[model samples]
Target: MTNEELKKAALDYHEFPRPGKLGIEITKGFSTPEELSLAYTPGVAEPVLAIQANPEDAYRYTAKGNLVAVISNGTAVLGLGDCGALAGKPVMEGKAVLFKKFADIDVFDIEVDAKEPKDFIDTVARIAPTFGGINLEDIAAPSCFEIEDALIERLDIPVFHDDQHGTAIVLCAGLINALELVGKKIEDVRIVCLGAGAAGIASMRLAVDLGARRENMLLVDRKGVIHRDRDDFSKLNKEKLEFASAASAERRSLAGALAGADVFIGVSGPGLMKPEWLMLMAENPLIFALSNPVPEILPEAAWSVRKDLIMATGRSDYPNQVNNVLCFPFIFRGALDVRARTINSAMKVAAVKAIAELAKQPVPQEVLAAYRKNSLSFGPDYIIPKPIDPRLRDIVAPAVARAAVDSGAARLPYPAHYPV
Candidate 1:
């Protein structure tokens, strides 16, 4: 479709359907007067009194266990960048749709107008009791780190920043499969990351937790490689400072850092990676040019430069799409099911492993039909499970819940429905 046509279709999709992507639906019937009394006045009071007496009864009496609040400040709406909270409503609604459709989790998309991190954090914490889990979306870096940290510490519920850890989980999953294809170990590989924002920092940190060495990774922001000798080292945030590399005169630029690197993961903007730069990397390099709509380098362009390269992107047209949808819904499903205190590293790692393992299994007929492909297998071309794969809910959710229970982050035992 033409760009104009695509734009029109998207606008029409949201506008024609009641001017938004989401709507409220009453799960229980209340058509008759008797049903109404039982649904609201008398029956509702019983649950309210029960919850008042025992705070934990809210989960049993209300919809809180199945509900998620997808909150955002609109400061970082995808690649749009700081469009403000009101303008980010559509994306938040789309997230709600994903939650409901993928994992049967209900969501309320909240667009908070608070510009200050503390205010946003406070607002979410104050209203935490109404929902089972909170999924933070599209908040900017540095502040996002602080907001998520404070909220996680303050709230007993599972609080997660999907832009950071969700992207990290899926990225790490694909990377795990990609490394296997290329015969490279995460600890031994020389990694060059081209974005030092939320996704970049989080993905790199999670990679470290999964056995990648901190010293072996090079993190580059817009200014250049985040090296120790940089005069602005003090200006770096705590998260960014953890990955700062020792100053090397030869490794000041991205091109310099890419030299002999085994992997290149780009969360930066378009056209930042040149085709010729692919040659500077080690043989059989893995390139994840994950900038959306348009990647740092196009897949075809990268593949033409190096046939030995294993590439993935944030776009669906390409193979090995590192989509966050693969993480958040299932993660929340598992968290809510197990009543996890927080979506911790162990749960995230379980998600990573589950997604990675799913890709290695034979592609089911249903999945192939959805993609309209006759064949797909575990190879460089197919390193991650498709978002539409039906098995994701069952596979990822249980793994995450088990991890939460094992890690002591969960408040309840695993649900019988999700048996071991």
Candidate 2:
């Protein structure tokens, strides 16, 4: 479809069916007066009293166990920067659709207008009781780091910033599979990331957690390579500081960083990476240009420059799309199922492995039917499972839930409904 056509279709789809993308539906019968009374006055009070007597009963008697809050401050809505809270509602509602469609989870999209990070954190913390998990979305850097850390510490329920970890999880999973296809080792690969914001930092950290060497990775922001010798190095946030280079004077620019690098992960804006940069990378380099709407370099342009490169982007039209939709809903599904207190490194890593592994297996017929493709197998063109793959819920959720249980982050046992 043309860009103009897609624009019209998207606006029409959201507007035609009641000016918004979501609505609440009654889950039980309320046709009769007796049923209405039972649902509201007398019947509801019994569960309230039970929940008051024992705090744990709130999960048992209410919808809290299956509910997630998709919260955002609208400072960083997609590629549109600082669009504000009201402008970000549509994106949050779209996230709600993914949660329900992919994992059978319920979502309440919350957009807050607070400018200060503490105020945003306080507001979310105050209302945290209603949700089983919190999915923070599209808040900008520095403050995003602070907000996520504080909420995870302050709340017992699972809190995940999808912009930070969801993108990281899917990208890392695809990277792992890409490395296997290219015969490269994560510990030895020379990695250069073009963006040092939330998604880029989180992706690089998760890569390190999966055995990618810290010294081998170089993080570049707008100023250039993050090096210890830089005069403004102290000004960088604590999270970015951890990955600073050891005072390297040799390479600073994106072009310099790309030289001999085995991997290039771009969370930066469009046209930031040139076609000639791909020529500077190591043989069979893995390129993830994940900027939405338009990537750092278009897949066709990159492929024209280097036929050997394994490329992935954030666009569904292209092969190997590193989408957050592939990870967030299922991760929340697993966390909520086990009542996990936190979505830890182990759980995240488990999700990464499960997603990567699924791509290598035979693609199900139903998945092929959904995409209307005849054949799909693990190769340069297919490094990650399709977002519509039915097995994702069964595969990723169980793996994460198991990891949560093993890591002692979960409060409950392995669910009986899941496969043993």
Error of 1 at 8 (Å): 1.4
Q: Residues 340-382, candidate 2: write the lDDT tens digits.
A: 9999999999999999999999999998898889999999999
Candidate 1 whole-model C-alpha lDDT, 0 to 1: 0.94
lDDT of 1 at 53: 97
Error of 2 at 380 (Å): 0.8
Clashes of 2: 0
The lDDT of each candidate is 0.94, 0.94
lDDT of 1 by residue, 1-420 (tens): 999999999999999958998989988887999999988897789988998999999999889999999999999998999999999999999999999999999999999999799999999999999999999999998899999999999999999999999999999999999999988899999899999989999999999989999888999999999988898999889988989999598887999999999999999999999999999999999999999889999998998889999999999998999999998999999999989989999999999999999999988899999899999999999999999998999999999999999999999998899958
Model 2, poorest ten-residue lDDT window?
A: 245-254
TM-scores for all candidates: the values are 0.98, 0.97
